[model samples]
Target chain A: MKTTPEQSEQRDGTATGPGAGLGTRERIVRATARLMQRQGYEGTGIKQISREAEATLGSVYHFFPGGKQELATEAIRHGDREFAEMLRRALESRPDPAEAVLAVAKDVAAELRASDWLDGCPVTATSLGTAAHAPDIRLAASEAFERWRGLVRDKLLACGFGAQDALELAHTVINTLEGAEFTAQVARDEEPLLIAGRHLARLIDSYR
Target chain B: MKTTPEQSEQRDGTATGPGAGLGTRERIVRATARLMQRQGYEGTGIKQISREAEATLGSVYHFFPGGKQELATEAIRHGDREFAEMLRRALESRPDPAEAVLAVAKDVAAELRASDWLDGCPVTATSLGTAAHAPDIRLAASEAFERWRGLVRDKLLACGFGAQDALELAHTVINTLEGAEFTAQVARDEEPLLIAGRHLARLIDSYR
Candidate 1:
């Protein structure tokens, strides 16, 4: 349960002292992404974003003219890149797709537990909260999922699976992980996620 | 795309003309559940619930003095009952656990499509939006998920699976379906759900 200084700051939702070296715009986007990870779109506000980023309100508007919506879109993109990077690293960790799937799940569970289950998939929490109301935000989330699926699909294909099987399993992998993460966060336990990972690995092995 | 009268009413978020025969409290709870399915707890309000239910603000307060949070908990319970009923019927439709998992997925996809993808899991949407802030709502959602996993586990056990396998696969079933449903709704397509369902059926068969 002991968190590092950076993790403690994120848990408090206060100033992002670790990111002080980064630029103002990057700080704002990262701050927004972090906030949206815990609370959904409706629960977050531009004023709070400013406070967390340690930037003035005027600087926030100057960086993003469209206000919260624009800032949130960028945050979604930021989260997307981070997750994609994680997926890339995990996919490369194992030669076999089945083991790779398990690795991805383990990584996600570790991250969630590290945050004390307070953090969840950034795209899912925000997109589900807004639903059809925010087209831009929804589109960002949709693209993030698609990219993750694509990365998995490619790994499966390279591992010698057919296109259809790879495509279907890719969808299953992302969907299951997204679902397991939400369940784990709510229960404040990592068992659901780890179980999901084990089952997904078995599923991939069956296809092989 | 064609909807019945009741479905159309829900789409418009207008008066529940079809539920005129139900009691005032039932109508209020149903309305809250329906609204929360599309929008999370934070996005919904007491005024909208009263209007949708065709009940006065006084009636709403009279039934639940705790206001939105109390009503939302009831709505989660209502949603839990409805989903549990659906799971029962689906599980009963097929003797095999694999087929039953597919049936549950198909039913969920059909329901979402019938609602024009405006609807999602009632508990997930509300809980993720509020997350850790509303203890009652969070507890209600947690209980709902546990009940669902239990139902699935019971089915697997009846089909001759061991206790450990049943429990883990049941978690996988609920978690995967929940994830696929959210992805399908976000993409405005049912393919993710159906794909997840197909893969889940295969996973169950492998267990056999």
Candidate 2:
């Protein structure tokens, strides 16, 4: 679910520069990311990925020799990279740390709504379902989680919390958002996210 | 993976009522819960469930005539029941609310480790992955979540928080635990649970 290129290029409408905006490899990965984010690894198939990416089956095999496992792992890693950047942009813009945390939750909820709940955390289902069989995917997911946690901790530290306190708060931030996203998607309502935001805001404020 | 019949029977070795101790139907459901809890919906197969449950294919078909979907939805629903009971018991024994919360997290973490991380929220991955394909399972999961949340809110209220505040706190408590369990399993460690336990304890104490 880590769509590596978070910028969401226009998909290079014209075939003039096939490799310019998003080449064959990029398309396959992006398509995999999108599908995996929604339906997860087991729910998605290689042919579907090839079709969605608009890449020829031959090209998909060419780009990913190991096929779905390789393709999904790469897709997840790509999503991991892009999401970390998205989180940074969402959180860094707000000057106040506590406010920034709440903003991050709400902003992510908006993103979920924008994607029609198709994109929660690329890693949630994708990792849990696939990790037992694919160690590489598990490692990628774990790394992505650590990256997100580190960012949240740093933000809290900047906001004047002690290191231990910041670490704990950081965990709370990610944990609530992750669970909230799952519930929101299941219920097909954004209320869970908003509730999470309000409760998280109170939790953050209680730091005083 | 709702484990119904949550009174925690000792697995009646020599059933006074034959098929009561580890009955074929119950075994199939329990096996499905374990497999689905770890591997999720699409990742688990009926044959595997049959083998794991030590039941014949005919018996499996007899128990779950509708096959995988039927068995899985039943499994998740069963897990929901069992988990609600587990949550109730975990949260009920302690007199001090904050300490109870911490103890619940720790006890569950211990349980997760005992199962080698195979026993996370029974419906977590199962519900998220199948809710789109099966609405009944989704409803069961939502109902189970609300039931659990109500229990937690009641606990918080008993601990002296206002009704509104208790509701929000209950949501946070569940949210954090769900996400932390996912992370801890993926990372193959219990630190996330302990981290969540501490943060949740502090959050609970803030109300006082």
Candidate 3:
């Protein structure tokens, strides 16, 4: 079933279920993620999130209770899970590990292009912004990265790479995709993504 | 001649110079670069830059009249040059490209650990933050990435790889370093860096 905005908001705690209720909580988190993706955590504001979500300040406080940091934590968690699932599906699409890895890179490239290069790994900007300011958020972001890395490592190991080699390859592949995304986003082009994908394929081929 | 902090500030714009005062304009650029490496552009404020450099906000404005955007542009330029020079020097320190690449990775690991895992590629975090918020900064970051890629490609090409292969390898190496840093920073461990360095060395060897 297609989830309406209202449904999503209600499910995620943004709005009161039923009439005259604004889903303040869910809307705030979604808006926070969107703003952070575009302008970064420090650059985004609670007021903007409230306005974007079409909710009042009182509603935001009612849901989050902890303000911006709480809202950001929830948003980052949501983004992390969404991205991890996306990556896993991308990786599992192909039986061959090398093919799967390249496919994931291509998928990310397409996603970025579709967003007009405005969107990228959601945690990237937040990870940087919160690194020095909020260690708790940083730890949450770190856990998200590890989960993704674990997925890649498992896939490569299943493809016959030794444990050590598999782990290293996974690390390299994940980072390459990330670094390439950052570069491609900045360049507003897909060349870096494509180039990084090809290199990752080569590395996998060498292992085989 | 040893320059006092006051003399250095007068000459370079920063209270302490990384080396000689390249000049007031260059000093502001270099200080911004160093600060970005540690704290990212978003987290590092213009006021902090001015205070750290012992320059008036007006002096900073006078040098980078466009404000933060202009300062970032100059910093990206300086970072690109510095990274290229450093990479070239590391590569030249050994005749074998594979060995040189490994040496450079090891050196990066050492530096990262020494900084208590607090440092990373300024371009990585800065690019992530600016790509969505500022198009001009995005372009500048892209240019810097391209320079680094070109340098790596040149080294790989000299090692007997085809043009396409060289470019791919370059992207992979750069990505590995960057991705590892991201993970390491979050995990607060040096293992990612060390492992990535060894893995890159092995990847290079496989080509031979």
Candidate 4:
């Protein structure tokens, strides 16, 4: 059987095909996420994404028929999953739930410090930019948030909080994490993240 | 005595003079703030602000010699003060500190609902947009946040929390409010705001 151009490209990771391999798609998504993280959804362009991804315009449209909005939706969902997994791993590394929450906070602070406070939660940036301009993107971002919240809620429930209490606590945890991220990013200091994390730990302790 | 052009414009609720009248400046700032509340600092343009305020581009430059950045600075500061004042009034209106906090939360929720969740904290959009691109804008945003945190801290202290406790609590409250606003705006729902407020009340109750 002879492989078609699209099939060959899909298999070789050099062309646009259903089997175009994961690397190409990953690269495109990563590039789009990075640009969106810096300039926001409205400010970023598909051309820039193509250039950043080292792929051509045809390749982008081939992979994402819905164009920038669809590409952004995919990138946001990818980032949310990757970030939540990383955070969950960080939390699980600690023995105590309180300590795990604090550890995750520190990890967030460390990441910000390493990036010179230039990076923030991609979901947050996307949510703000598209909440009004693009409803589908907003919904996609909201799904990511609910997923992250579920992760946190499960952790709190494991720590003995009731289901209702755990849900509320999870909301606070995420809210504080996000809020502290913005504060730390703007101030170029880890104090906000550290302080917010400590306060979150105390909140968990009260439940215990 | 004949009224100067500035004086006449000031009296007539217009700004058509050399120095520019209070009405014109106020209108410009208010319009800019409103635009920023919906979009963001980078997302908005001077032309848009001029049109919204019913003024000319020349008038914007005349009022803000430093251009868009300068206009944004003034608008963000004005927003900061207005938000602080609203918080203060809300907090002061209620006898109990916890009740005061809840009241402000309700007020914030109502405002968002009234606007169909289109409006959000003015500085949030700007802060996220400028966090990576413009350092000066980021600094300005940070200062505004510090001022807001200070106000919230004072209210918490007045309600009987210790200085350290109050500061920590204030940080959480602000973070929750900010996060909730982001979620509400993205979800196009007011429930997140109310949920954040209720969670905040619980945290405060535990301390009290």
Candidate 5:
């Protein structure tokens, strides 16, 4: 099991240590993702990203010449890849799609709790209300979601499920997990996500 | 069958005409909710609120001395009540709880599409990424989620689901719908929500 830099940063839960060793561009993108996870796109600023990454403001602009919007798209892509990696690992951990889906929910709940509810799905937080105004941010978020859904769909198809069932249930899995994560974060409790995991597992098993 | 000011405003999908006739305080709250639904809390500003509400800055401050946070709390409450009304109607529309749950998702998807995806759930838009920082906004959002969960739990209980089953399914219902609504908004398509509706209905039917 090889751990990517993004995975290590997520496990470390902060942009220090190995995160600091990453290049300035990677550091800035990671910082932006972390900030947007906590404060959202509009709430996060370049100065804060520079401060968080321990990089100069000039470096942030040097990497992201288009400024915040461009940087946010990259940050979202970073978040997207991180989540996809986690999802892939979870799905591979079990031969049964039901078990894999349950694993994802459990893993997500644990990670969110470990982050003290601060590390939400960056894509959802950044793009929640920006769809009408920020096309790039919204597009990045949408792509992230689509990618996750695609992964789930592929796994379900690899199982015995039909194509239509796999597609629709993939949407259900992603939507339920997304919603459950938000509820769990707000309540600062893991019950919602845990319950979602159990029921979603049952739903997936019924298809078999 | 009677429409309250909030219901009318939601139906109108704008803060004009009937929205204007509402008193300034109500107007301000409605405006805040609408803006936050599209732009989120941090992205929405006081001046923008005043402009949308057609109220003076003095009047806005006079009504909510705690400023944007206070006003946002009220706006969340406004959104909460409006959603409660919709949920109540949806739950009451059919004799079977499963049918009712499906109806709720359908109605929400239709409403989001009608708003051109600008009108998202106010509590979610305002509270995402802020739970760790904004206690007041976080509390309001938490209350709204709890209230919605209670509505679903009560409906499930009335349908003869065991106490434990009702409670857990209630969480699933809200989490899935919330997630589905978000995905639908980002995709500018209703398939996610519609799939969620079908799957949830099937999930509920499994209990029977």
Candidate 6:
């Protein structure tokens, strides 16, 4: 049997689905995340996700009876948590919290360049596309943000900052990082992110 | 003749267009802005814009020979500038720069609540929808961010900060505020923005 180009790409699992080894259901979720990261929620198509996941359209419905909205909600929640964990692990490589943040920022910068600026946290992007009708997706995105904030807050707590200051600084870092990502993508440059990283490092140092 | 609901809405021009007194061409632009603000670039339909604007479908093509993309580009540019002006005027009503920022944040929070969270910075939302394929729209959004950043920089310079620090602080404030707005929308609360405002005010105070 001959495979089409999109099917061949899916068979290789390269263009999308970093976790191609996952089950069919999870593969669909990953593919949804990858597509949404680039084209955003409305821009991403279900047919594309089905092809990318190497699953039939029926499988998508089987896994998510609520259709694209359900898949999108899962993708947002999964992508955000997975990205935050990767950031956390990479950040742990440095001994100092400030340096760790700088290091993580550098890592994300490299990833952005590698992805040709196609990748971003899709939670807010998805929320923008669905906020009118899907309250559950909005709430899921909010939880994802809170979880990411906790990552920063935990690092500060470990760095010996008090809870109050840690919480405040966490908000600052998360807000700055997310904003920089948007600016960086639009500008087609990573300098905004690098500058944000430096500023966060300085901010953390001040608290230290 | 008595008007139907949608016709009444179009005549009043209040369900969407903030500028109810606008001419037909301008009304089309304003209606596009309002729908795009709620549903994003891909989600907003040109027919809907025409209906909301009370303009004929023929007029849409007449104004935008370039079609939906062209209309979208115009809508984003006009909406962002108009919204910024309103924010600027209101922000200027306060005496001090810090107070002005806080006031602006408060005003946006109120607006968000009133709009049922349908309103956001349409420039960023539109860019996300167009980022993968449309370079023109992305550049428009980048310019819009620059314009907004200038708003903060001007205030900082007036508040006696050095030119370099003013620019940096201005970036910080814009990035944080944009990011906070996203977070607030997802959370369905204004606390993120309020916290961001207070932090920005403190940063400005330190420079002062």
- True interface contacts retained by model 3: 0.62
Model 4 C-alpha lDDT per residue in residues A1-208, reported as the tens digit of each score: 1233233344334544322434556678888887787677777889988877767898889879999889889889977988899878976777677788899889999988998887788887766756678888889888887888888888878767899888877877887788888888888899889988887888788877
| Whole-model alpha-carbon lDDT for candidate 5 | 0.87
Model 5 / residue B208 / CA error / Å: 1.3
Would candidate 1 be rated incorrect, acceptable, medium or high by CAPRI criteria? medium
DockQ of each: 0.65, 0.55, 0.56, 0.57, 0.75, 0.61
Docking class of 4: medium
In model 5, the Cα lDDT at residue B160 comes to: 94
Chain B alone, candidate 2, TM-score of 0.84
Binned by DockQ into CAPRI classes (incorrect, acceptable, medium, high), candidate 6 is medium
Better of 3 and 5 by lDDT: 5
**Per-model lDDT:** 0.87, 0.79, 0.76, 0.78, 0.87, 0.78
**Candidate 1 lDDT over residue span B1-208, tens digit each:** 1223233333333344747655667789988998887788878888998888887898899889998889989999999999999998899889999989998999999999998888899999878756657888878988999999999999999999989999999999999999999999889899999998999999888887
lDDT of 2: 0.79
Q: Tell me the lDDT of model 3 at A204.
A: 82
List runs of model 2 lying over 4 Å from the truth. A1-21, B1-20
| Higher-TM-score candidate of 1 and 3 | 1
Question: Which structure among the candidates has the greatest DockQ?
Answer: 5
Off by over 4 Å in 6: A1-21, B1-20
Real interface contacts reproduced by model 5, as a fraction = 0.84
Provide the clash count, candidate 1: 0
